[model samples]
Target: MSHLPAVTLNNGVAIPQVGFGVFQIPDAETQATVSTALEIGYRSIDTAAVYGNETGVGRAVAASGLLRDELFVTTKLWITDLGRTSARDALHASLDRLALDRVDLYLIHWPAPATDAYLEAWQGLEELYAEGLTRAIGVSNFLPEHLDRVVALGGTVPAVNQIELHPALRNRETAAAGAAHGVATEAWSPLAQGGALLAEAPVVAAARAHGVTPAQVVLRWHLQQGHIVIPKSATPSRIAANLDVFGFELTAAESAAIDALDRDGRIGPHPATFHG
Candidate 1:
């Protein structure tokens, strides 16, 4: 089993640097997929209420035979449920589905600024954190302004800011903002969905030089930079391969080469404009 390194959050909670993500995996298939990931040594699992797979994640955890403390489970509150009372209820509903008393981490799925309710949601997350419903609280798909707003509220600083980050879309500004506020930056699409990015010159050169796949090379880039990355794949071979990134180290020139590939290529919704 690969013993992955962990990044300590500002709140003193430790999260595995590399984790398994079930973004688009259907609820019915989530159990077997997550089960495979667990069997292959992935201790961190990232899902969301909108994914409709918390039940499956719960089932996988229940059946994995691993101790409760042995795994790190993360789920998010959707935009539609963005208020103090609504967020609390949503978390309880999620807890029931996850079959656990408390989650390792809980994130606001999106800012949904137009709704003008994320602030209330953040406050609610603060309360949940205090109530021990979640060990830590954070946000996802949040931009610099959004992060600033949360910090300005003057409660608990968010422990993390999960974002759509990859070689093609480095998102340096938002990441810098999170860093400025002591929030850990977690990369969601760390591989850019495995299309043209894997075929890029720098990624390919790194792969050939290291005798590893392009995906592994890209994952190493994120890891070497200290970003928390979650790369998901339904294929068992790929799932196992993604966790095998801890074996190699990227040199300075190679890392910079991949860094230059950033062209503001964003594959997901823009955090600033996305209402959900």
Candidate 2:
């Protein structure tokens, strides 16, 4: 059995706190990579239609021999596929690619304020949730204002707000907003792609002190802070090590040092302006 702790969503669907992400991995390689993650005890898989790898993810899931109930799969609706009817059709296409009848969680990939269609897309998600097409629905890369607007619509509150959160970019405001509305905060690039952030003094010191890698230290910090993290890696060792963070705990001082590293370092597009 997977030992990773579960984070209950606002709708009470349980998601693994440390899930596997298939962001940049090519479609041709996703099946083997995701299969490795599954073999390593990762029960959660995060994918997107734009990733162009849902078919590979589906292949891996089919070959794993693990029961469907043993896995938690998540996918997103691309900006171009916004709107009530289109969103439903988009999810249908995604389900066809994933070879599943329904996804565990479906998210609006971006606010795309330029299109102003996220609200309508959210309406579609509500319909999907009601129809059992997805167990839960949420958004990604949403700012505080966008989240507020979604909540104001008086539909189902988002179950999660997946964002680019790392030691360099805490995204405290958005996270706090989600918390106030009972939406769970999920960190996408939790390690900041592992360059300077991993080499920083605090991260290195914590790693040395705990006999873990800097990546593990950072993942542990995120877990202790109660943020669900989906860290992606193609290397077998790193993929396995990423999920091996539960064995150690970081001291308050260590966590605080990482917290102080936040410098508004956003690595992705601002949700306010991004159209796609």
TM-score of each: 0.98, 0.99
Off by over 4 Å in 1: none
Q: What is the lDDT of residue 227 in candidate 1?
A: 98
lDDT, candidate 1, 18-110, per-residue tens: 999999999999999999999999999999999999999999999999998889999999999999999999999999999999999999999
Model 1 scores worst on lDDT over the 10 consecutive residues at 1-10
- Give the worst 10-residue stretch by lDDT in candidate 2: 1-10
RMSD of 2: 0.8
Q: After TM-score superposition, what is the CA distance of residue 48 in candidate 1 from its true location, in Å?
A: 0.2
Error of 2 at 181 (Å): 0.3
Q: Where does candidate 2 stray beyond 4 Å? A: none
For each candidate, what is the lDDT? 0.94, 0.95
| Cα lDDT of model 2 by residue, 1-276, tens digit | 357799999998999999999999999999999999999999999999999999999999999999998999999999999999999999999999999999999999999997668999999999999999999999999999999999999989999999999999999999999999999999999999639899999999999999999999999999999999999999999999999998889999999999999999888888888896
